[model samples]
Target: MDIKRSYKGAVEISVILLFTVMIFSCGKDTPGTIEPEKKNEKWRTTAVKDSIGNQYYVVNTLDNKLEIRVDNKEGKTIFAEVCPTIDPAEIPSEAAMVITGVATPNKYISINDATLVLKIVMDDVKIQKKYIQLLANINLDTKKFYTKKYKIEKPEDWTIVDYNNVVHWYQNTLLVREGTDYDLNRGGGFMGLGQRGTQLVCYERDFTIRYTKDIDANLASYPSGSGGQYIPINNFEDMAFRSDGLISRVQIVTSVEDEWAGKKDIVWQNDLKKSSNIPADYSVRITDYNIQGDEVIASYTIFDEKGNVKYKRTGKWALSNGFPRGYTTE
Candidate 1:
């Protein structure tokens, strides 16, 4: 065994150990100091339509590349292999490549076609190239828009079978309107029985108003009636659906001149004691009744055009099926 180590040998070993320790230490490459490499984010697709009504999906991938595919009007894959070079910010970053419901009609795929991948790509990008598709079942383009809508609340109430498609609903409101008429006589001869002095006598009668959702409700045309006899709003009496769909509920609209309706005793309120006429500013709505446990009662409501509840009619509903009068103490 050596009694003492050589100074030269010790110095050489120490230098070697110092160099190893310095090399192992991560000075600038420490965990917190190093930043992460950014990933390519996806962007929503853009759509372009040609003159002949064809749609194409413009997609920008994560690696800053632009791609286009036919979204609708199949077999029109002329844009295949035409990957335009563009930044990813050209499209919506959060938007997924989608096939909107507007293209439902033009969706078509042939079984004989060998290529299952719809669009052909040419550019080599870092992002994973995936085919995305969203489709629709029914076609909405060719179907003619029908503006007629009918809301039939009860199953067997008033229905337009073949004339117009009826949409049924569970809750319905019945509107039964009654008005009063007057029979006047003048009394002068005998105990107010004979007519000489004027005496006002009155009785009530049914207004005979009808309800229909038809756009052509036989209400006289407006503006034409203005010059001829009545006010412009007085003649307009038709309603139609804004779009063709099954209507579960509807608000029947009516327009009338405030002065004319007031003077003519055309009471929208249907009150015998009080006078009610259509307001020029506010709207009048009466809910038609539907069947509720063998009972039908019309309900009415009046509100401003903004849907604020202003006035509500009494709950005195006309019962279709009830016990005979005087049977129950009201």
Candidate 2:
């Protein structure tokens, strides 16, 4: 009787093991009918938008040759241009011609309509003809003035004389001044000099000037409840065109005192004025203090040679504003 019972238990265990194996085997093969791999789908595409709201789609294969599609409003595709084959090494870092991406060992075409080429190059080193699109031009009797052109289209090369005569090339865009600033005429439009999206700025001769910190002493003697009152440096933002003719550097100076009367309670530092100074002229004059109260407000203004104000702004914070924080660990 004992042997018969043991044999029955062994058969039951064998049946359970067989059922488990069949379940796993069935899972390995999906239930649906297998389809053949597709071969005709040769190219993959990705779409990007420029600053001007134009849409560009890039179609590419594994070997890296490209076809670009530019679409306008109403969803109509306007252009389909084939990009020339290029070696990665021959491309300039700021080449507005080449799209940029994370270049890997495989060297796949990662980005198609990237607008970063020209501006990126301008940021690092100077170029010869940095063509920029004309944003606006004023043909005055005295001097021609240009404004709001894009950076990509700035000229690559230029020669200026004593901040009076100017000449520069931005890509296909050009700005020339034959006489003094008063005699120059400032209206012309061009394309291929800037990013695809932004409104074009008018072109002008590249020039430079010396700037210094303008501080007020009497305004520096103010009162405070806990910490000393503020000192504003909103006037120090200045924009300068590069030697190549693109408005490249914007220098900003801020004034904030860390301690007052040896009491060190309220810290004063205002880097907040940097962004506010963008619209004003490259030369800035900041008024350091207020006459009514110890609370200081920095004022900035752009002026003509005769000191007529062209643009002006006021700064909000001092250097004492606490350090802002946020960063990704990865």
Note each model's CA RMSD in angstroms.
26.0, 21.5
Q: Give the Å error, residue 109, model 1.
A: 41
lDDT (10s digit) by residue, model 2, range 233-305: 2222112212211221122221233122232212333332244344333444553323123223344554555
Residue runs of model 1 more than 4 Å from their true location after superposition: 1-281, 286-289, 304-308, 319-330
- The best candidate by lDDT is 2
- C-alpha RMSD (angstroms) for model 1: 26.0
Provide TM-scores for the models: 0.16, 0.21
Please give the clash total of every predicted structure, in order.
Answer: 14, 45
lDDT by residue (tens digit), candidate 1, 26-52? 645787766765533355345545335
TM-score of candidate 1 on Cα atoms, chains taken together: 0.16
Q: After superposition, how far is residue 77 of candidate 1 from its true place, in Å?
A: 33
lDDT by candidate, in order shown: 0.28, 0.30
Off by over 4 Å in 2: 1-41, 61-65, 86-330
